[model samples]
Target chain A: MDVFEAVAEPTRRHLISLLAERERTAGELVDSLPALTQPAVSRHLRILRETGLVEVRPDGQRRIYALKPDGLQRIDDWITPYRRFWRDHLAALEQHLENQ
Target chain B: MDVFEAVAEPTRRHLISLLAERERTAGELVDSLPALTQPAVSRHLRILRETGLVEVRPDGQRRIYALKPDGLQRIDDWITPYRRFWRDHLAALEQHLENQ
Candidate 1:
């Protein structure tokens, strides 16, 4: 799956948000989401890694995961052009709000 | 599917890029993509509509499609936090370029 599809799920998005703060071991990541089974978290991490949104490295017996900022460039590039539309609308809204 | 999944396909992304410029009828969209069968294009359009990335309205005997800027807010919001990481990196790269 592409990065877009990888991030479509809320669980994966949450994992990304967590990794944004700092790198974490697979165990630490699983622990962070106590509600999910260890396997479930691992599955999400695998998808993220496969999509290049997250990078995994060996840390002795454990695997470390961190957000790969480069992987997100595709998404950022895709959204860049469309930003003008929203930014203009948002700017107008802000102006209207200030007047009110 | 969510907006991310909806836009994962390249064809869907193309349709979005097209609609970003102007509203088009379904037929016009299909005409723009001569390589795809009419049914295939329709399928993509349906997915876009279902995901709320594109909105359709009755235009005489045809339906008009346009990019729904509000629908993209979820994606924009998701990327907002990550922008700092990329922005910082990009700014540093720009400074380095100027120095060189």
Candidate 2:
């Protein structure tokens, strides 16, 4: 799955956001999200790993997950053109707000 | 559907990128994507419209579709924290390259 598809799910998006803050083990992620079962979180993590959004390293018996940081560049690159479009509109909005 | 879900499909992403360039009528979009049937293109456009990614308006007998720049802000906002993480890593990489 691509980053877009990986992040389409709310739970996976939350997982990415959480990993962005800091590295966490599966247990910690599970603890953080009480609504989801451990299996569900694991499944999400696997998808993230496969998509290269999150990299996992084995630390003794526990596996630690960290955001790849550069892994999202594909998505960032895809949106770069739209960013200009947004920036132009945003500048217009800012000017209007200033005029107000 | 959320922007991520709306954009998860490659064809939809292509449609969005195409629209970002300029507003296009349904016929124009259909012509651009010759691989897809007209009905398939119409369905994709409808999905984009429903997701707020693309706004549609009637022009004569054609429907003009334009990218709704702000509609992608949610995905942008969600990636903001990761942007910081990415920036930090990019800075480190830049410094490393300079040292080489």
Candidate 3:
């Protein structure tokens, strides 16, 4: 799956959210998502790995998962131009709030 | 459909990419994506509209489409925490480049 497909899944997105804070073991990730089973989390991790969003490193008995910033460049590139839209609107909103 | 389902389709993402530059008419968007037929483009636009990603205003004979920044807030909220990953790596990369 591509970056788009990888992020489209809410479960995978939640996993990314967890990793955003710090690297965690596969067991730790499974504990965070109470609704999902270990196999389901494993599948989600596989999809994330295939999409290049997450990297795994062996740490003796456990594999640690970490966020790969380069993997997110596709999204950053896609959203870069569009940021002006928010900046412009936010500036206006700030001015309006200041006036009020 | 929800935001996830709406953005998962590649045609819809392509339509969004076009609108990122500037607003366009239905005909204009159709012309831009030569690979897809007008009906397909219309369908994609419908999905974008339902997801609140794009808004439409009538210009007499034609409807003009524009990007809605609020629609993107969902993504922004989702990505906010993860942005630090890029910022940290980017700062390190910049330092590395400076040293070279």
Candidate 4:
């Protein structure tokens, strides 16, 4: 699965968001997603792992999942050229608000 | 449709990437995606426009679609907290390389 396919699922995106802060064990990740079953979260993690968006390190009996920055580099590269659009708009909005 | 649902499709993401550079007419967008039929591209654009990821302006006989940065703010916000993880890792890698 590619980055596009990995992030296509909202649950996976949420998982990425959680991992963004720090690495967590599979059990910890499951605990965070209270509404989702362990099996469902495991499936999402599997897809994320396959897509390179996530990496896991085994520590004893548990696996710690962490966000792989390079996995997100594609998206960052895609958005780089467009950053000016939002920055400019934000500047304009700030100026307008200052005048008001 | 919500942003999650709107971006769940790969075609829409590709369209978003194309629009990131500059606004394009519906026909222009269609032309860019030679693999996809005009109807299919149109549907993808419709979903993008509905999700607020894109905004369209009518210009005489054409409609130009442009990126709506605010629509992406959610993802940006979600990524902010994690930026340090990559930055720190990159810095460490650079230090290690310099030592070598």
Where model 2 places Cα greater than 4 Å from the true spot, the runs are: A94-100, B97-100
Best-performing candidate as measured by lDDT: 1
Rank list by DockQ: 2, 3, 1, 4
Chain B TM-score of predicted candidate 1 relative to the true chain B: 0.86
Summarize candidate 3's per-residue lDDT along A1-100 as a digit string, tens digits: 7887888888888888888888999999999999999999999998999899999998999889998997777776766677778788889999999999
**Candidate 1: where are CA atoms >4 Å away?**
A91-100, B90-100
Candidate 1 lDDT, B1-100, residue by residue in tens: 8888887788999999999999999999999999999999999999999998998999899999999877777788888888787777789989999999
Candidate lDDT (C-alpha), each: 0.89, 0.88, 0.86, 0.83
Query: Residue pairs in steric clash, candidate 1?
Result: none
- State the displacement of the C-alpha of residue A48, model 3, in Å, after optimal TM-score superposition: 1.1
- Tell me the TM-score of each prediction against the true structure: 0.83, 0.90, 0.84, 0.82
Clashing pairs in 3: none
Better of 3 and 4 by lDDT: 3
What's the candidate order when arranged by decreasing TM-score?
Answer: 2, 3, 1, 4
Local lDDT at A73 for model 2: 77
Candidate 4: residue B10 lDDT (0-100): 74
Residue B64 C-alpha lDDT in model 4: 93
In candidate 1 chain A, where is summed lDDT lowest over 10 consecutive residues? A68-77
DockQ of each: 0.54, 0.68, 0.54, 0.47
**Which candidate should be chosen as best, given TM-score against the real structure?**
2
- Which window of ten consecutive residues has the lowest lDDT sum in model 4 chain B? B73-82
lDDT of 1 by residue, A1-100 (tens): 8888888788888899999999999999999999999999999999999999988999899999989877787888888899888788789999999999
- For all candidates in order, state the fraction of native interface contacts they contain: 0.50, 0.55, 0.39, 0.26
